[model samples]
Target: MTQTATRDDDVAAGPRASAERQGDVRLSLQGVDAFYGQIQALRGVSLEVRQGEIVTLLGSNGAGKSTTLKTISGLVRARQGDVCLEGESIARLPAHQIARRGVVHVPEGRRVLRGLTVKENLELGAFTLKDNALRRQRLEEVYALFPILHERRHQDGSLLSGGQQQMLAMGRALMHGPNVMLLDEPSMGLAPKLVTEIMRIIKRLNEAGTTILLVEQNARLALRLAHYAYVIENGEIRMQGDAAAMREDASVVKAYLGLGD
Candidate 1:
């Protein structure tokens, strides 16, 4: 079973502060279907992440949440639908191509390079960019958001604590100035304090104009940060609505939030 983290003290109980920051659809998956060899992972999954919005996907383990993200980032090719970025079809593009188009995926497990310095790992994220000046500018931006990474810029990426690695993973994605980011299970395996810190940073990222599609294990925390949400179950989207509404939903409370009087 997938373990879920509870909301930090700072995570509020209602609508996110950035609820009004939504814009036109920045990314959309229309009836997307994906498979691994013979096993179907996503069935007619459709969703949207509007510009400047923090949208989250909530579900249990093996509920196709990660697969939905993979499909958007082109890590998993869609067998029968469209993955559109700003109204352009990108379902058939390769993962690298999708990333170059500013669809960054910060997958689960942190995935920091074992031997590379923190700076090098961040530099890898900017590989798609050709301008040296722009790369340096982005590096500074990342450092500003994660000062610890700046302190350990020369240290090995794999040597950082789990929380720091999560920051590095997120900071690395920001290196390219992504139009839309697919964050899968970011708060997994984190201590409560670190989870609070990560969620705060994620909120800051959204407030700073980054469009995010988050797949989080902490439903209450995810709902707290998100402007809107979707709940996936058994390879399909079972529910979607404004984040505030879902938080008060009896079904959501019982199944995901575990809240009862």
Candidate 2:
């Protein structure tokens, strides 16, 4: 379910308020190609996320959405391509080095550490920070963003509900004071109410000026929330457009948005 690739407008005139936040390019991937053993996972994939904008990558399962995120975060190497952060090439950097550069990846399935207390899991995210005062300040900020986590600070992260775990995952990422957040399926497997809550938090994060690259299967929601979007299939970018145009695209509505089924 891919439409012909379209260019993303410099300014997204979408209904989302974040359109006004779009600024200089914060992250860019140029002609990226990746492989897992003998299997190719990404084929000349290219995309860019602007400062203070929420850009969504849409695809079904195994469409390389997660792989794309991994590549940006340096968890998966780009076999042939340029992954740049603010005009500097980071393609060859190690995962930790990339993290130090402010690219945070909140992986799918809410990978919260089961044995660690909720607070402990969050503190681990600030490992790179050397200043205790800054770390404490960041911790307070995360707690404020998620009061439930503060309430459950003593409890193991895995003991929390699905939504709570998702909060914990996001809280952990926020601790790093990330420049760009690559969120993979933040809404997966949550109840409808919880989904709405998570989406609201994501919106809040963006409004507070965190650049985001969101990979979501919920096309209707993604299109509604994002400033811009890219659709990929079989490891190739098949479509790209501002969210407003994408929501109105007939092929996109039928395929990802579940219309005309």
Candidate 3:
């Protein structure tokens, strides 16, 4: 089912945190309009993320969440408006160019290469990098964050379980040390423990200065992990506010929290 968009559990996102101090704008989506052929998917959508903050987009499936990420990543072109990173326009750049600029996208379904080994898959993420030392540093850092990947570094990524493959996809993205990571459904199809683990890792990434633009189906989890959030419906933003404020909103409970009567 397409999720009902809402926001809840906005207690500073992860455990032991308070209101976050938003910093310099790291990524900006300004008056974006997108389409799939003749069909419009995003209508003047705009949002911003600053350094070291988790900004989430909450919405039902087909509400343009994934499309938004695709636009930022340059997988899909923006027909109108501009996408800027660190104040430079990139709305018309190709996908590889966007990745080179440190806007990494971890798309849904853990799109890892099935035939490639875990290490090989990670190496692909650094295709833009020419420096061998930087690649080695990122590889070691990814291994440090996900020790399971280190243990199975030689195994084909397809051989790993769902949770492990998710880690691999994330690790591969980190090989570029992205400034703004566009994550789509990071917690989908995982057990409760795995979900918690992934969320914790996401929080850690944000803490380490990677600005995040997350699109999630799990509203409560999304709010619990984000500092600010926007709600989208029918390809338009319906609401936006601080995560703490969204948690207690009556509209969120009824639509997304499944408290509808």
Which candidate do you rate higher for lDDT, 2 or 3?
2
Clashing residue pairs in all predictions, respectively, total 0, 0, 1
- Angstrom error at residue 6, model 3: 16
Give one digit per residue, the lDDT tens place, for model 1 in 43-139. 9999988888899998878899999998888888999989999999999989999999999999999899999999999999998889999999999
lDDT on C-alpha atoms for all candidate structures: 0.87, 0.86, 0.84
How far residue 196's Cα lies from its native spot in candidate 3, in Å, is 0.7
Off by over 4 Å in 1: 1-8, 12-22, 256-261
Task: Identify the runs in model 3 with alpha carbons over 4 angstroms from their true place.
Answer: 1-12, 15-21, 256-261
Best by TM-score: 1
| Per-candidate RMSD, Å | 2.2, 5.2, 3.1
Runs of candidate 2 exceeding 4 Å displacement: 1-21, 255-261
Model 2: lowest-lDDT 10 consecutive positions: 2-11
TM-score of each model, paired residue for residue: 0.93, 0.91, 0.91
Best by lDDT: 1
Question: Cα deviation in Å at residue 224, candidate 2?
Answer: 0.6
Q: Which lDDT value does model 2 have at 207?
A: 84
